[model samples]
Target: MSIPLAERIRPKSLDEIVGQSHLMGEGKPLRRIIESGTIPNLIFYGPSGVGKTTIARFIAENANMTMYKLNGTSASVADIKQIIAETEMIGGMNGILLYLDEIQYLNKKQQQSLLEYIENGKITLISSTTENPYFYVYNAIISRSTVFEFKPVTPEQISPAIKRAFDLMAQDIGTEVMLEEGVVEHIARGCGGDVRKSINTVELCVLSAENGAKGELLVKMDTVRELTQRSNMRYDREGDEHYDILSALQKSIRGSDENAAIHYAARLIEAGDIISLCRRLLVIASEDVGLAYPMAVVITKSCVDSALQLGLPEARIPLAEAVIMLATSPKSNSAYMAMNNALEDVKNNGPLDFPRHLQNKHFDGADAKVRGQHYLYPHDYPDHWVKQQYLPDALKDRVYYEYGENKTEQAAKAYWAKVKGDKNG
Candidate 1:
C-alpha cells in the first residue's frame, strides 16, 4: 500500500521536524529532559496538527526504548491494564514508553488507573491532548505529569516547511513550483499556525497546477485566496476568532436581527466563549437597552455575576437567558450611537473647556476664579428647570443623545418636558 503524502513525509528525526524550535533549541527544558534519559511522566498540551506525535516518536527512537502506543479515545481500562502487564514482562535493556494520544478523552476512572501506573514509575508516560488539561484531566493524573505547552506554528517557522514540501514535490513532478513572495506567509497565517493544514493546502494547490507546461509551477495569490475563502471556520483560543464571535454578537444586536443575535450567541456558547458572552451582554444591556428597559441591564449584570460565581455548563444557563432576553427585547442603538458620536468629536476636535462656574471649587484658585460665573443651579430654580450652557461653548448646539421612542423613553421624555416647560410650548 502506498503511504499517504502527509505520512510519507513525516519527520523521522528531531532535525526534520518543522516548528517547535523553542523546545528543541539548545539548553531548552525538553532537550535537557531527552539528554537526561529518564523523563518524568509528561502531558503535551497543544492544538492539533502541530508536531506532538512526531516529537514523541523522535524521543522514543532516540532513547531506543520499548514503545507502546494507544489512543485514549479507543483504549479501554482493560486494554490499558493488559498493556501495563505486558510492559513489565518485556525483558530488555530499554525501559518502556507509553504514548497516549488525545488523553483528555479518558474518563476519571481510566485516568485514575493511569495515574497509579505513572506514580510507580514502572513505565514512562507521555500523553497528548488538544483540550485544556485543567478542565478535562483529573487532578491526580495532572499532578503526576510534567506539562509542556506547544505554540502554533509562526509564519517565519512555516516558511521553511512550505519550501521543503515544494522541493519534495518538485523532485517527483519534474518541475519547480514558484510560490509568490509572502504567499506561504499568507497561507501560514490563514492556517492560523496549523502546520498540517498549511502543508495539506499547499499540496492541494500544487496538484491542481498544470502539468509540466510552464516556466515555473507558480502558486498564485488567487489560489491562496480561493483556498482560504472556503477554509473551515476554526475557533482558535489565542487568535482573532475569539474576538470575532463577540463582534458578530454585538453587530447582530445593533442591527436588531434577533435571529442572527441568537445564532451568534449559540456559536459563542458552543465555542466555549463564556466570559466573552457574559461581558458583551452586560455592555449591551446598559448601552443598547439602557433606561428604555432598566431591567435588561439588571438582568444582564446578574447573569454576568452569576456566571462568575457558578462557572461553566451550569453558568451557560444564565448566559443563555441574558442572550435570549437581549435578543427578544425592543431593540435600540441610540445610547451606543450617542456615546460613539460624542467620542468622535472629543477625539478629533480635542477636549472643550468646561464652563468656569461649573468647575470644582476645591482647588486653591477655583473659588476665586470660577465662583459667580453666571451658573444656574437647576435644583434651586422652578420645577428644577433652567436653560444653561451645560455643554462647553464649542459643543453648545451639538446633539449627543437621540432618545428612542420606546414606552420607557417616552415616559422619560414627558417628565423632562413638564420640568423644562419645553413641550412644544
Candidate 2:
C-alpha cells in the first residue's frame, strides 16, 4: 500500500509542526534542546497525531548521529541488542540516536536492554508514548528522560495543516481544487485535534469528490460530512485519558457547571461506553451529591437503569438528564467524607467491639452482658428517636458525620439538635 497522506505530508522540521507550540514555540525548552545540538534521553507524551513521531523524525534528520527507529509493540530484545551492539561500535565515532515509538509497549526487559547504552551516552534515546509515561514506562526510563507533553491541536491550530494538505492534493491532480465554505474548518474540527487524521480525512474527501466543469475538483461540505461521520476521538476505556473524562465529568458536576458536565457526558456517550458512564454517574450522585440532595442517589439510579434498558442514542437522553440534574443540584460530600473517615479508623485501628446495645443479641454467649442489656428501642419514644451511645466505648465521643450546609441537610441537623436537647446546636 502507498504511504498514507499523513505520513507523506509529515512535518520534516519543527517549523512545519502544527501544534505543541508549548514545546516547539520560539525559545521553548525543546527548541533550545534541539538547537543546542546536545540532545538528551527524552520522552514525548500525548495522544496520537500531535507530533511525537514528527518531532522524533525531525531530530533523526537533523542530528549528526546514526538514527535507528523501532516500534515498541514489535521491537524485541534481539532488535534492541542489535541496535545497542551497533551503537557500541559507533560509540566513539558518530554515536546513535534511537527513536522508539509507543514505548509503553516495551516490557521491563526490553527497556532495560537499552539502559546501559543510554546511560553511557552511546545511545541518545527519543521515546514516545500515548499513555502517561509514569504509569506505563519503567521508573528507570522515566528518571533518565525529560518528558515533553503534546496536547491536541485546536481547530484553529489545525487549520493551516488542513490548508496545506488541500494545496498538495490540488497539485497531485494537476488542476485547481476549490473548497466549499466550511470544508477546511469542518475537517479541522472533525479530527479531535489530530493533525494526521485530518490529513487522511482531507485525502479521502479529495479523492471522493466529483470533478466539476473544466476538469476542476470541487470539494463540498456534504462529502466532508459523509466521510467524517466518525471523527477521530481518542478514547481507551482502560487508559488514563478515559478516566480523565470521567474525572472531568464529576468535577464539572461538583463545581456546578452544567454545560461542562453535559459536554463530557456527550463525549462519553459518543465513545459508546454507556456502562462506564452509568457507573460513574451513579458514584457521582452518592460521592459528590450525597446528603445535600439525598434523592439524587435514587434519581441517578433510576436514570442509570433507564439508560441500560434504553441503550445508546436513546440511552443518552436519560444520561443527559442525570448529568444535568447532578450539575445543577445542590452539592455536598458530607456523607462520603464521613464514610471515608470512619473507614480510615476501621482499617487502621483494627476491628473493635460494638456498643453493648448495638451488638447482635444472638452473638451474645453466656457473656450476654455485651448484648440485649439496657437497649432502648427508639420507636417507643416520641419522634421515633432517642439518644444512645452507638459507638464503641473508645469512639463514643468521636464525631464522623458533620451536617452539610444545604437546606435539606440543615433542616435534618436542626431536627436532630432539637431531639438531642443541645441548646447550642
Candidate 3:
C-alpha cells in the first residue's frame, strides 16, 4: 500500500514542524539545542499525534547518527543489548541514536540496561511516551535525559500544515485542488490537535473528492464532516487528560462557573466515564459546596443514583442537573476545612483523650469508680442545648467549626448566637 498522507508529508526540518511553540518556536530550548547540533539523551512526552516521533526523526536526519527505532512494547532486553553491541561495528563509527517509543512499557530492568551505553555517550537514547514519563520511565533514565513535552496543535497552529497537504496533493495531480469554505477549519478543529489525524482527514477528503469541470479536485464539507465524525474527543482514559478533566470539573464547580462546569461534564459524558463523573460531582457537593447549601449533598446523591441506574446518554440529564446545581449553589469549604483542621490537631497532638464528660459511660456504680463525675445533661436545660467542654482539656479553647459567610451558615450562626447569648456562637 502507498504511504499515508500524514507520513508522506512528515516534517523534513525543524521549521516545517508545527505546534509546540513553547518548545519549537525561535530561540526555544529545542531550537537552541538543534542549532547547537547536539542531541542529548531526551524524553519526548505528551499525547499521541502531537509530533513526538516526528521530531525524533528530524534529529536523526540532522545528527548523522544511525537511528535504531525500537518500540518498548515488543523490544526485549536482548534487543536493547544487540543495539548496544553495535556500538563497535562500522555502523556505530559515528554514533548510535536509539529512538525507543512507548518507553513506559519497558520494565525497569530493560530500561536499566540502557544506562551504561547512554552514560558512556555510545548511545544517545531518545525516548518518547504517550503517558507521563515521570510515572513510567525510570528515574535514572529521567535524571540522565532532558524531557520536552509536545503539546496538542491548535487549529490556528496546524492550519499551515493542512494547507501544505492540500498544496502537495495539488502539485502531484498537476491541477488545482479547491477546498470548500470551512473545510480546513473543520478538519483542523475536529482532529483534536493531532497533526497526523488532521492530515489523514484531508487525504480522505481528497480520495472522496469529486473532479471539477476544470479538471481540479473539489473537497467539500460533507466529506470532512463524515471523516471526522468521531475525531473531536481525544484523550487517554488512563492518562493525564482524564485527571485534568476531573480536576477542571471540580474547580469550575468550586469557582461557581456553571457554563464551564457543564462543558467539562459533557466532555466526560461523551467519553462515557459515568463512574468518575458521578464520583467527582459528589465530592464537589461536599468539598466545594459544603454547608452553603446543606441539601446539595442529598440532591447530588439522588442525582448520582439516578445517573448510575439510567446510564448515559440518558444519564447526562441528571448529571448536568447535579453539575449546574453545585456550580450555581452558594459555595463554602467550611465543613471540609473544619474536618481538616481537627484532623491536623489529632495527628500532631498524638492520642488525645476525649473529655470524661463526653466519654460513653453508663450511670451504674461500677462505671465511674463509684465517684461523682457529674456530666451535666443538656436535655434538662431550657433549649436542650447547654455550653460544655466537648473537646479534650488540651483542645478546650480550640474552635474548629466556624460558620461560613453564606446565608445558610449565617442563619445557623444567628440562631446559635441567640441561644448561647454572650458566651459563644
Largest lDDT belongs to which candidate? 3
- Per-residue accuracy of model 3 over 1-425 as CA lDDT, tens digit each: 17778888988778888888899899899878867778899999976788888888878778888899999989999999899899999999879999999999999999999999999999999999877788889999999999998877888988999999998877766878999999988888887677887888777788789999988889988888988765544432332245567889999999999999999998888877787788788889999999999899999999999999998678999999999999999999999999999999999999888766666864556655446546889899877778887888798899898999999999999988888995463
Tens-digit lDDT track of model 1 for 44-87: 98777778888887777778887788998898999888878876
lDDT for position 65 in model 3 = 85
Candidate 2 residues lying further than 4 Å off, grouped into runs, are 89-92, 231-251, 257-263, 272-425
Give the Cα-based TM-score of candidate 1 against the true structure.
0.57
Q: Tell me the alpha-carbon RMSD of every candidate.
A: 14.8, 9.4, 9.1
Error of 3 at 314 (Å): 10
Check candidate 1 and list the clashing pairs. Answer: none
Error of 2 at 165 (Å): 0.7
Clashes of 1: 0
Model 3's lDDT to the true fold? 0.86
List TM-score per model, in order.
Answer: 0.57, 0.66, 0.66
